[model samples]
Target: MTDTPENGAAAPTAAPQITSRVLAQYIRDMSFENILAQKGVTGDAQPEIQVQVNLDARKRSTDNQYEVITKLNITSKTKEKGDPLFVLEIEYAGVFHVEGVPEDQMHPYLLIECPRITFPFLRRIVSDVTRDGGFPPLNLETIDFLALYRSELARRAESEKAKAN
Candidate 1:
């Protein structure tokens, strides 16, 4: 039953509340190779690091459940000699139970928001792996998911435009 105002007009229905929960998070795969150690390079080496990130999302068999994966590839090379230092690759995934997000916004929510929730853990793992692999801990700067998403969209638009021409 809807509550009516004193004038007896019907009240508008309220919108459904948005809800989301992370069901599980895990490192689906990871690998770290210390190339400097294998090469027997022992002097003080300044490192230049490059990091690449990619995201993916897919629906689960269970209703209202989705899995999002963040893939990272990181490489470090010596600044002076351009020698390989190390390479780290990881795929991290989160399972989320979500409700009330409009379909149009669901893609962004899964790709942007879910990865935001899981990134800190992924960063910590990177730092730990680098330190354990015989280099100083490599702390990653925070990622701007919104900017990344926007750039990806722009790239796709450019690709489509090129194809049409």
Candidate 2:
């Protein structure tokens, strides 16, 4: 966006646009707690840390296409509280609607834009959960939405190419 003016006459801008509106949002579900049972890991389990992560996204079929939802879950386990730690599972998902929009624009917005809008809350949740679990806040690393978008496109392209062949 830019302002253009000459001779003190301002160019008229287009009418106000509301891209998407939140229909309804509430905590779908949430849980956070510390597992004191973890202490037994040091006595019996192998000295190993296990980690797994996943991501999923979906869009509503309604015409408005203005509603989006995302959830992130992370579970960590270590050989012992004082030993190396690992993320047993990190499942993140997003639901979005981009109706009345051009496909070219919506693709990136869903993959990148929506996440940009939602990541802060997700990050705060992660940090708070970790801290409440008796560990230092899990200040997550930054994400590159553009890179993720490119990767999604590449994956789709590869899948289509494979189908064609």
Candidate 3:
């Protein structure tokens, strides 16, 4: 038995279903510089690593398609003397076909959800690059996309406010 309206009628509205598919993913650009190897640094030296991440999203010529690019700049140096160790820069991009998301939410969906879907592959590449460059594998911690999105929005707001002043 189903609960019906007082007049014995059924509900007429349902929410739209959201669907997303990854059409393709690739490394758009990458560069790894082994500064330590180039400088010939020897004798057990400590390593300090820094990583920076940036994101961009743009619409494709095709309908319902968008491209999201994640850019990472990584550097490693010796903790003791602050000598250079290695630097890795990479841009990874994904093509997604998305449907049913509201227009207002498309930006966040593209920046956050799409990157979250493709992050594992990016992580693997970073780890492999570091290991192959003669250092231990560098495993990155999980990123909080929601927090990142909010921070970026706040930054843009401040920039616009300053420009107006």
Candidate 4:
């Protein structure tokens, strides 16, 4: 037993902890399309583009690691009820080695942090694919990961409340 100089309490001697996150990243899946099947399908009006995004995270059985995936789907059409111009879909995933993160913090870390690291690559891919598909490069805007995470939490809470009712 040892005593501290001021309070007469022994301080435990332990090595400092090290926390690691996002060890590696890679594109798990990607897809692009030009439904029009023609180089320039220029019509009288510019096509309307719709973008949809989704995110999911899960823990690995190996422990202290997680898999995070971000998927993006885009569609372009002349109007609400018109022939589709082009469709693009991408599913990107990353393997993250998270350590020393509390259970409460793990969810946000995976959904927000992991996606932040992976989005740039995904964005570049989208741009390249659209360019090669014979259209102007589609540069995706930066996603609001924090807002997405919060919305997901709210959705889950609403679902649980509905179940209770």
Which predicted model would earn the best TM-score?
Answer: 3
Query: How many residue pairs clash (N, CA or C atoms closer than 3 angstroms) in each of the candidate models, in the order given?
Result: 0, 1, 0, 0
How well does candidate 2 score on lDDT at residue 124? 76
Clashing pairs in 2: 65-97
lDDT of 3 at 110: 97
Query: Per-residue lDDT for 80-142 in model 3, tens only?
Result: 788889999999999999999999999999999999999999999999999998899989888
Model 4 Cα lDDT, one tens digit per residue, 40-89 = 45565356888899998888888788899998899888764567788998
By descending TM-score, how would the candidates be arranged?
3, 1, 4, 2
Residue pairs clashing, model 3? none
Give me the runs in candidate 1 sitting further than 4 Å from their true place: 1-15, 42-44
Residue 40, candidate 2: C-alpha displacement in angstroms: 3.9
lDDT of 1 by residue, 44-127 (tens): 688999999999999999999999999999999888878889999999999999999999999999989999999999999999
State which candidate has the highest lDDT.
1
**lDDT tens digits by residue: candidate 2, 51-152:** 222233456667655444444445555545444332322333344444445655765566667666666766777777667766677776666778866876
Q: Global CA lDDT of candidate 2, please?
A: 0.55
Estimate every model's Cα lDDT from 0 to 1. 0.93, 0.55, 0.93, 0.82
lDDT of 3: 0.93
Order the candidates by lDDT, highest first — what do you get?
1, 3, 4, 2
**After superposition, candidate 4 runs with Cα above 4 Å error:** 1-18, 38-42, 79-81
Question: Model 2: which ten-residue window has the lowest total lDDT?
Answer: 45-54
Candidate 4 or 3, higher TM-score: 3
TM-score of every model? 0.90, 0.57, 0.91, 0.79
